[model samples]
Target chain A: MREVAVVGVGMTLFGKHTETIRELGEEAVWAALQDAGMSPKDVQVAYAGNALGRISGQEMVSGQMVLREVGITGIPITRIEDACASASFAFRESWLAIASGLYDVAMAVGYEKMTGATTAQIMEALAGASDTELEADLGITFPGVFAMVARRHMYQYGTTREQIAYVSVKNHDNGALNPRSQYQKRFSIEEVLASRPIASPLNLLDCCPISDGCAAAVLVAKDLAPRYTRKPVWVAASGQASGFFEPGSDVTVLKPTIAASQSAYKQAGLGPEDIDLAEVHDCFTIAEVLHTEDLGFAPKGEGGPFIMDGNTAIGGRIPINTSGGLLSKGHPVGATGLAQIVEIVEQLRGQSGHRQVQGARAGLAMCLGGFMHSDAGVVAVHILKA
Target chain B: MPETESTENSRIINEKWFTETPQGKALAGSRCRKCGRTYFPRKRVCVQCFEDGRMEDVALSRMGRLYTFTVAEAGPPGFTLPYAFGYVDLPEGVRVFSPLGGDFARLEIGAEMEMAIGPIRQDDGVDVIGYIFKPV
Candidate 1:
């Protein structure tokens, strides 16, 4: 296998976009090309990740549709659908393409347009992320599953609703600094605790908003990366794991995330202690706490205390979700994973203005897709060395 | 099913789910004969030991505690909003997500809970029979 480096990363400002999904894809790709000091002609192959809402399911072969805009039509393109981890998996595949010597340069894009779908349509599309035979049949939604985890964390650890609210409060503050962040507003812990309840412990303020945006990255061989950029974030490790289909795993402890992170750290010859910053999948507030613990930033079941104690704050022991994460950055499903990579790239390059972690040397990002049985259908983790 | 007997009334109907009495009969699941791994909805193969086609039918404990929960401010198609639901970690070590019966606060984490089949909600005039972890 060859050494892999992210030569360039770019994206459109994540928020409600009136532009078509194809246009967003083109914009993101153009930005990446510009960053890479290359053009549409440089990429050898392409992989795109796109998901459909209830009514948005009408569109088929999303990769072919978007790649047409950039005039890279002939290169083999694959459309990925890994729920929220769609683009993350796409990015992973692109990394593999470069690492496995399959391609010297590969284009990875993640695009989604939820502005066109109705609320019901969106919920129905989300249901597709679950097992069609069991959980979805029970009308279970993603928030519903996380909510159960939150409730369990509360009971087992006496983790307060305040700790969950603290996550939103902190992410909002981080999001406030990100110009590309979809959510520009900030929330107080009090505001989160008093917000209208969505399911139970999770309130309206606790949930991430639906977003429409796209992000893209261009990966090249490590030796060739210097030709494009002076600072290419080296891909230290990329690891993925899957979980049980039934809701059997302890929600209080995120097992799949731990295994995936551990595998990634081992592969990279690093540990959680070496990470200076991270962008974890925080689709919900509790998800962030669980992620911190699972990724070995904190001990098992002590995730709540970590948050309450402000250990994950930007200036604290380890800055997390520096891009506002999915909670405040806006979760566009298919594009979220690549978006994390893009943010890490920016932080590494010292391009992130206000949200940047000072002198960050290493970074980690994680994405989980699907929920059933005891596992998150899939877990993807990656480490980057500056 | 009458609304009183049913727990919810969501429109999407799934016939695969059926009511089970905890004390009456054991619900069918799969246990890895070699590795002792268990699966609800039962697996034909053991995932842990990588043993193919070696699972045997086993019964699971119906009792457990409420692990966590959330309410959907927005609901799925054919389902209503503000519904109570969460994951229940059974004594057999299986954590299942199900609707919570009665008040939302009663669905506390670590609260003693047991499985029951009841209406999920009313949808298009049909009551949905879904599983839940009601406070014991």
Candidate 2:
């Protein structure tokens, strides 16, 4: 195995867009290539991550179609899908291609056009990520799943609704500093609490909006990284795991996240205390709380209070979601995982202006895809160092 | 007689999910004869023991405890808004995801719940009957 480094990262402003999926993919890819100081001809292999292209009328050969716009052809272009973690898996594969000495330079792109579909259509499509026959057919929406988890967490640990609502308040404040964020406006705790209820214990403000966007990253072998950029963010570790179905499993802790994060921490020869910052999956505000604990940043059942105390805020003990997270930054499904990586890369390279964690050297990114048997169906955890 | 044959305005959501035993309508599940693990909606093989042809059909308990729940204000197509659903932990160690009936406010964790069959939602002018849990 060899070392891999992220030389370039790019993302479109996450929100509603009239641009086609291919066009969105092109924008991010072009920006990434430009950032890396490389042209399309420099890429050896490409991986594209997309979840709802079929719903948007682009079903197969998504990678080929998207890369064709950037003049990236006659190469091994594979389409990867793993629900919301689609892009993260794509990045993992790209790292593998370089680490295994199969390719020196590889690119990963994740794009999703969710705005074009109807609310019902989009909801139905997102629900497909779960056990369609067992859960979706029973009409359990994503919010409902998280709502149940929030309720259980509250019941088990005395976590208050106010503490959970505080997560939205904090992330939106960070998003306000990010020009590319979807919802740049910050909200008060009372305002977030008073927002229209989507599911019990979780209001509208607590949920991430449906969005359309794209994010891309360029990775190369460590030995060749300095040729493209002066500040290369090394891929310390990349870990991915799927859920195990235990009927009576605890809903509060996502086992796959723990499994993946443990694998990542071990590979990186680091612990949670060593991380200077993190970008976790906050598809729902409660999700951030869960990931905080699952990633070992907070003790189990203490994530709500840990976040409520401002421990995870920017400039706090360990800043989290400086990119505004999926909540305020907007969750474009397939594009979310790579967007997280983009934020970490920028933070490590001292590119994030106001939201930057001062003197940060190491960062972590965690993403969850789908819910199954009362837990996340898939999880991916990655560690990056400056 | 099979429950589906007796109803005209409604039908069970999945025919293989329920069985009419002497004790009344009960959830049909598969038990791994090799490992004694059980599953709801049945299974072709035991996921725990990974033993083929070592599974037996069994009727699940009608009563269980509410593990967790939520009142969903919105859901996918065909679901009525503001409906309640939850996980019911049965004595067989199988957690069943079922729609909750009766007063939503009264639904509490660790509360005893009994399984009941009713219309869960409407599908193209017909009631999609399925199993539900009501406070006992």
Candidate 3:
């Protein structure tokens, strides 16, 4: 396959919005095109990631909506939805398309307007990705499932409730530096631990808030690099895996993430030890710790202790979630994956003014999606280099 | 009177109550003849094996382990909160998601459980009889 490099990445601030989903995509795409030193006309093919638009009475094709606005049409545009990893998969697809010589330049963007949906509608849509008979039938919501995992970790690892709140606290610390973060207000551990419980043992702060946002990226061949930007972050490797979807399998750990990450590491010719920084899918506080362990950044069951060591801060051994991750970055499902790419791009490009990881070389981005029946629908990992 | 059907694959679809035979008497399940896979609520076609006909009837074990569980403090508006929910991994190699009855303190893994079905919940003003596990 031909080598692909990310020429530019862009995203909108995460929060409530009056703009339509198409507008969100348009905003990000416009910024990304400007960053790539090109317009919508430069994109030969496009892919957009969106989880729900029809529920709000806007169905049809998503590609046409945004592309039509940008005055670029008649080219291939597809919407991909793999839950939270929706945008990352789109990024992976764009990279492959360019790398395979099928397209010299490609654009991938993810947008989600989740706050528009009512609470019940949101729950049903989220549950639609789960096992119908096993989970949906019993009205088991996503928070309930995540709470199960958090509770299991708490029981097995003796992880206290306060430590769990610290995850949000740490993420918010980074969020405070991030103007784009949703919850920029810093919270204390006691405040988080005292928050009302959404599910048993899972306080409100333990869960990432539903958010609205969009993120986009432009990928092209390394040979065509300097044409778009002077310094392009090289796409070293990409890997993805799916696991069995049954509660019979254990939820204490993520098997798909481990497998996907290993494959990515093998392809990149680098191990987890070489990663200077990372952006993990912390849809929940526990998810960050689990992903850290599953990605081999830490040993088994040592993730809690590893985070407690303060090694994931800006100056730590491997600063993580410099963009505040889903916890503070706001998990607008479709937008989350691409947002991770944007954060890593910003960090690698040395553009992260305050939250930048000094001398960051190679970085890893892990995206996990569709936790159903104890199985993660897809786990995608990408290694980027400066 | 003896039912006289020992084919290990025959059962009436309308049999609301479970049939208890002399030798084997527990909860009966349907087995897909093509793949030999079993399911608690018998169906015409097995989700697996992709084969629809010639499914056999069998009995499931009376006990299972509490795979993973939680006390859901908040659920749907109509549904009551603070209910114990979990999946029971049966000895028959099938995992069943159900509610735990009696006491939450005693809900432990590898606990013996028997199915108790009743109007455990109400939805849209309709009574729904669901299954729950009781420590046996």
DockQ of each: 0.51, 0.78, 0.36
Candidate number that wins on DockQ, 1 or 2: 2
Model 2 clash pairs are: none
Ranking by lDDT: 2, 1, 3
Candidate number achieving the greatest DockQ relative to the actual structure = 2
Q: Which stretches of candidate 3 lie over 4 Å from their true place?
A: B1-56, B76-78, B105-111, B120-122
Q: Give me the overall lDDT of model 2.
A: 0.92
* Model 1 C-alpha lDDT per residue in residues B14-100, reported as the tens digit of each score: 432332344633335677889887776676877678998889777777677866666677777656666766667777666665777
Best by TM-score: 2
Candidate 3 lDDT (Cα, 0 to 1): 0.79
**lDDT per model, in order?**
0.80, 0.92, 0.79
Task: Compose the digit string of candidate 3's lDDT tens values, residues A1-386.
Answer: 99899998889999888887778888888888889888677888888887766553555588678768777688898888888888989999999889889999899898888887776577667766567555665667677777777777777777766666777888888988999999788888888888887766677787788788899999988888988899899999999999765436778788999889999999999999999999998887888878888898888777777787888878988888988888887988888989999999988989998999999999999998887656787999999999
Q: Which ten residues in a row have the lowest lDDT in candidate 1 chain A?
A: A51-60
Off by over 4 Å in 2: B1-9
Candidate 3 per-residue C-alpha lDDT over B1-136 given as tens digits, one digit per residue, 9 for 90 to 100: 2232222332222243244656533556787888777776566787776787878877777678777677766565445767677777887667776767768878766677777644445555554545567877
lDDT of 1 by residue, A236-282 (tens): 99988887443354656666787789899999999999999988989
Kindly give the number of clashing pairs for every candidate.
31, 0, 1
Tell how far residue A131 is off in model 1, in angstroms. 2.7
